[model samples]
Target: MSVVSMLTPGISMNSFEATAHVVTQLEVQRVSYMLVGALSSNAYGIPRATKDADIVVSFDSIGVVEFAKSLGVGFKLDRQMRMETITNSIRNIITYTPTNFDIELFRLSQDEHHKERFQRRQRRWLEEIKREAWIPSAEDVVIQKLRWKRRKDLDDAENILAVRAKKLDWDYLNHWTMIHNTNDLLKQLRDECPNLDVLDEE
Candidate 1:
């Protein structure tokens, strides 16, 4: 469902507003984070509405609970942290009281690609948030989505390949996909998208 449709009616805060508020809170807490999930995919691929915002955070200075508490009114942080099965990362959910929208904060994991992707994240102007925010590179988004291989994720990866064909760093993409055992899937996506030129410039 679209973010607007998912929001509670008569609420002043829309999905972008709720996401912006959560991002502002993270900035206030001085947490290092990168926007991910549907939002990240939307930046590179076809635009699609999302009900919630997902972020990967490095909580170097403060504990998770304390950070959530600091969000103060209009936000409630779940005390119970859960393991995300696909990535096996710990995540906490924060509910925006006004709109009942969820903001998922995934603790940065020690996985090799996770660390590399965070390091490679780029700052882009987010018109919705009215500020520059960190987001994964298009190649990383493609790699991660292919690794996940869910129906939606595969669709997202294919869309990204379709839209960002010429600009992609094929060598870097090939290396990681091979390491993650997603090279075949990547190849399949590329093959399926007839408009994507098979030749790599780099």
Candidate 2:
């Protein structure tokens, strides 16, 4: 298990309470969702700045329309993007005007890798916020960051590798990276952050 002492944090998120508040709603609705993106990366890697939260949910029982209502009034949702890449999902965004905290929802897809990652997710208590959160496994988070390949996301990937390389499931990571053709990228990250590969002398 991963456990780090909380000596405050360097991450400056727009709203952690709003993120936790929405997570409570997802739990109440019995929805399967995992926190991804910068907010989540901050937990695994280094704490930095994050504007919004990315939650991938299976909209089988709960939809964005309903989730928006739970977010209270003045929250606008953008149900645009007919079809996106990989997951082939539309952008179902719920923006909380009070804090400008946006929760971008991606409808679960039948993609094999996504399914695996979703199934691999685990819930843990976040002591910093005193709430439980459904977070992607460390390995999956790293892989997704690489797949996204945004400049910030690539940075997140490197940071995560630097911090979590010891705890990460190398077998699982290698399997998916090879499938996604990101094995080279993974190797490069490991090269740059060589300490990530240095397991304790145990």
Best by TM-score: 1
RMSD in Å for all candidates? 5.5, 5.8
lDDT of 2 at 166: 72
Report the error of model 2 at residue 150, Å: 1.5
Judged by lDDT against the true structure, how good is candidate 1? Answer: 0.82
The whole-model lDDT of each prediction reads 0.82, 0.74
What digit string (tens of lDDT, one per residue) describes model 2 on residues 1-202? 3222222222333366656666766776777888877767777777777777788887667677887776555466876744558667566777767678787887777878788889998786654445768788878889888888788888888888887777778999999999999999989888887564453212
Cα lDDT tens digits for candidate 1, 79-127: 8989987677899998887778889999889888888999999987666
Clashes of each: 0, 0
Q: 66 in model 1: Cα distance from truth in Å?
A: 2.0
